[model samples]
Target: MKRRAWIVWLPPVLSGAFLIALWYAGRAATGLQSWILPTPGEIFQAAWNEHATLLRAAGGTAVGALGGFLVAALAGLAIALVLGGARWLRTGLYPWLLVVQMTPVIVVAPIIVLWAGPGLPGIITVTFLISFFPIVVNTTQGLLSAEAPMVDLFRMYGATRWQELQLLRLPSAMPYFLAGLRIAATLAPIGAIFGEYLVGNASGGTGGLGFLVYVYNTQIKIPALFATALTSCLLGFIFVAAVSWLNWALLHHWHDSFERHDR
Candidate 1:
């Protein structure tokens, strides 16, 4: 297990090292100034200097993303439940859902920010909008994808729709639901940042990463800009890692995907 864990981590570690080396080499080769492009060392220094501000901003973004993700998860599941129940609902509403999703986030964000008053509420709403569609799609498919034999057996036993859903369909859908969450996890932080960029003005120290990105770029703080960008990537990575852990915890024992490793 230790060996496997180490092996799993090795590639990324090496890749990161290689990238750092390349960053150095590229800067040396091009003779670019720090203002135009900062070195990794310079970025690290800026991040350390701005650690308090960055940490606070990241916390605010985290709150917004988590709040939005929770709302999206609950609402998405409820919608999926309704849509999965009847073919008519699926046919009528699903197409509309597609249309809503096809609409760009950029187009809708400003409108939401205006209504929600450029605050945490607005940020959460934007995040929810960005992360909503996949969960509904996946959960609806999972509900409908329950094994026919199991569904028939429940029907034969005179089970109600709710009972069947609770006993068989939801359990079947768990994997799919988690899959959708995994995708959302990657996206929620981005939405939060975007919201911040547009309307996250409730700043005590740091408004949010997106706002900081704007600040750093306009001020020509290249190293801090890179640091902020790296922080955003780390936040997304943490969210993804959390979802992956959830998947393993929920599916490791019974899911065929993991069962092979037991052998």
Candidate 2:
């Protein structure tokens, strides 16, 4: 198992290393100005120098992402449940959810910023908007996709609707719910970053990693900008990996996705 993971990770690690080496070679060969294309050494130095600032920005972004994710997960599940009870409601709301996802964030972000007073609330709203869709869609599918035989057995046992949902449907939904969560976890950062970049909150507060990127870009600090961007990607990967691990631990023994692989 450990070997398999190392094998899976090897390509990405090697690819990243090769890309960095190529970047270094290109930067060194061109002797381009630092602002134009920073060498790996310069980017490393910038990262080291700005570590504290970057850490704080990362923290703020993480907090908003987590808060928004939690709120979305709870509300999304409840909404899905309500919709599950009524086919008409599900059909009605389904299109709207699709519409919301289809709408570009750029068009909606300023309005959110204006209504929410910017900063964390605006970021959270954006994050929620981006994250909620997956949860609703996945959980609803899971809840409704309970195996027919099992559902029939529950009905034979004279199971109440709520009882059947609690004992049978929800358990069946766990894997799907986690899958959506894993997707949502990474998306939260994207939503938060988009919010920050679009609104440019007037609080004069340092916005977050996205803001950090904008600042570095504006200041012509190529290396620092790349470093911050890399950090944001790392944060996103971490979120996805964490959720994947949690899903494995929770469902590996019972869920087919993990169990079949284990076999």
Candidate 3:
């Protein structure tokens, strides 16, 4: 168990250490001004100094991301199910979904902000738009990917459409849905932060990490900007980790995709 744990953790630990070392070495060698490229230590110090404010901002961003993720997950699943069940619907709507996916979030975000107004709603909308595509596509594929033999068996057994969907399609799609969720976990924060950049509290008193990033950048507080950006990355890491944990908990026992095999 201990060996396995070490094997799992060692790569990330080493990578982090190596990156930090290189960062330190590059800054030491360059003798750059803090404003141009703040050293990692300076960024860390800035984060530490403004820990309270940063934490609050992180919390706000997290809330928006989490809310958007939940909404996206539910809506994506429903859309996938509908599209997967109906050939006509799939043909009609799937192309439009593709168009939406291709449309840049930068283009849509401002429109959302204009229509929804500045704050959490616009942020959540952006987050949902940015993160929901993978879920829909993956889930639709999964739902349709059920083995023909198995589907024939179910039909032969007199299974109703709803029964087949509930018992076979949903179970088959679990891994794909979770995989999409993992991708969305990283994306949700990006959407939230981007939205905040556009529509966050203009007063800057209470907003998300996105707002902090904007404020720090405009003020030319390089270390603080780096710190805020780091915080956003950390949030994405945490979200991905949580999704991975959930995936393991839910799928490890039954799903071949998640099953561990000792070499």
Which scores greater on TM-score, model 2 or model 3?
Answer: 3
For model 3, the stretches where C-alpha displacement exceeds 4 angstroms are: 1-5, 202-206, 260-263
| Model 3 Cα lDDT, one tens digit per residue, 137-234 | 99999999899999999999999999999999999999999999999999999988987886676434346998888778789898998999899999
lDDT-best of 1 and 2:
1
Best-performing candidate as measured by TM-score: 1
List the candidate 2 regions with Cα displacement exceeding 4 Å: 1-9, 28-31, 260-263
Q: Candidate 1: how many backbone clashes?
A: 0
User: Which ranges in model 1 have alpha carbons more than 4 Å from their true place?
Assistant: 1-6, 202-206, 260-262
Better of 1 and 2 by TM-score: 1
lDDT score of residue 153 within candidate 1: 99
Residues 59-174 of candidate 2: C-alpha lDDT, one tens digit per residue = 87887778788888898888878877779998888888899889988888768878986788888888888898889889888888898999899999999998998999899888
